[model samples]
Target: MFDSIKLRKQHGYQAIRDIRTATVKAPFRGFPRLDGEKCDLSCLACTAVCPTGAIATEPLRIDLGRCTFCGECERGCGTGAIQFSSAHSLASTDRNDLIIQSGQTPESFRETAIQSRREIHRLFGRSLKLRQVSAAGCNGCEMELNAANNVNFDMGRFGIEFVASPRHADGIVITGPISRNMAPALKDAYLSISEPRIVVAVGTCAISGGIFADSAQLDRSFLDEVPVDLYIPGCPPHPLTIIGGLLDFRRHK
Candidate 1:
């Protein structure tokens, strides 16, 4: 596949080398490397599901450029071998330099999300926090998101947290379809969050009502109830994507 001069010229030779190096070297690198702890390195779901066979078990490597980060491997792994990290510092000058996985546990990841939430709250000088509402969701999205606050994802890492009271929140995170029964509650919550604040729609359901589009009890659009600053599109996006969206908002503000 490397024979095309035009393609090679467009991407440069160094970029390709760096990508290969990252894939070969990544599996050997341990998590918490700074602490001298080694990853179990026992999980191989990424190898099995990699559409292009970019991941391999014998050498334990991943071709960065070829990786889709679809979280298929992470989700499929029963042992949590492949994981999402709060570390988003994967940018590189060379196209092939992106082969490493940060391997952050759900615990560390949540901690970072919480920390960001708190910082944003503090910046507003508000004692209140953010509220999360579920519309006509399959419960998978809600469960995954709620899981972040448990010991695993640890939403407290970023100082941002979820609150039970809408009045206390600076914004609202809505997940799933806007069920007819929940419409009033969703609207009330959106209105309760203080003004100059924002709303975030998570998952395909909240954005487009998703698979429940034909359900008589669900609304077609959630934006009708609240102004959304962000729309995360996924059946249930990985927790990292949700965190990334929030952090992006933080940076923009």
Candidate 2:
């Protein structure tokens, strides 16, 4: 028991108290920085190498919604025209706002990406329960979301939790590209939830289909059919980003 206590003491405070100021480790790409003037107009190497069509030249733009947070665009560029920053707060209320143009930084993106939702705060401010639906996710986003509720993140302290059923949920969080096979089930789950519910799309797949956007098997038309309140962009968003996005959306000033 003494040895266990010693180990616990050595671990110190596991949960992060302030997610906004927390720093992520190196090489964990979160946001892209694009410099249009530095790029060679004749070369389209960055776009060619990108598995997803997240990169585009002609003034250079990267859509975080479709980005997998992969560093291929950075490695493909010879003139250092593209690189990634470690900023993880990439959630946005507007889908078009995820596009990063020249002269934009992740620091700047945060200002407008999240807007204060007074109506939503009034509904689920003190307590929020969510139902997670994985349509056809590769499980990468699912794993990171699971980490958000672990002891290290301790999201429960804020009265946020994932419930077992949609009937008990205050909102729905979706992961994956919404394949045709899973569309009906996903819709049924959404309809099962009580009224005044919101929808949160997590990961590049859920937000914009990531690398699988072109896949013929997907039925993302469901997204057009229903309203989405939040869009969290990343190949697999960090736990801090997920927690911070939720807190920022519902927390009172």
Per TM-score, the best of the predicted structures is 2
lDDT of 1 by residue, 1-253 (tens): 6768779687553322221122223322211111102223565655677554435544444443344345555556565545544333222212232234344333343333222344544454333256888876778779868765655345556666888888778888888778888887888778777776767777656765555656798754447544555555445665545555465445423
The 10-residue segment of model 1 with minimum total lDDT is 28-37
List the pairs of residues colliding in candidate 2: none
| Candidate 1 residue 123 C-alpha distance from true site, Å | 4.2
What are the runs in model 2 whose C-alpha is more than 4 Å off? 1-12
User: lDDT of each structure?
Assistant: 0.54, 0.89
Q: Enumerate clash totals for all models, in the order shown.
A: 29, 0
Error of 2 at 67 (Å): 0.6
Worst 10-residue stretch by lDDT in candidate 2? 244-253
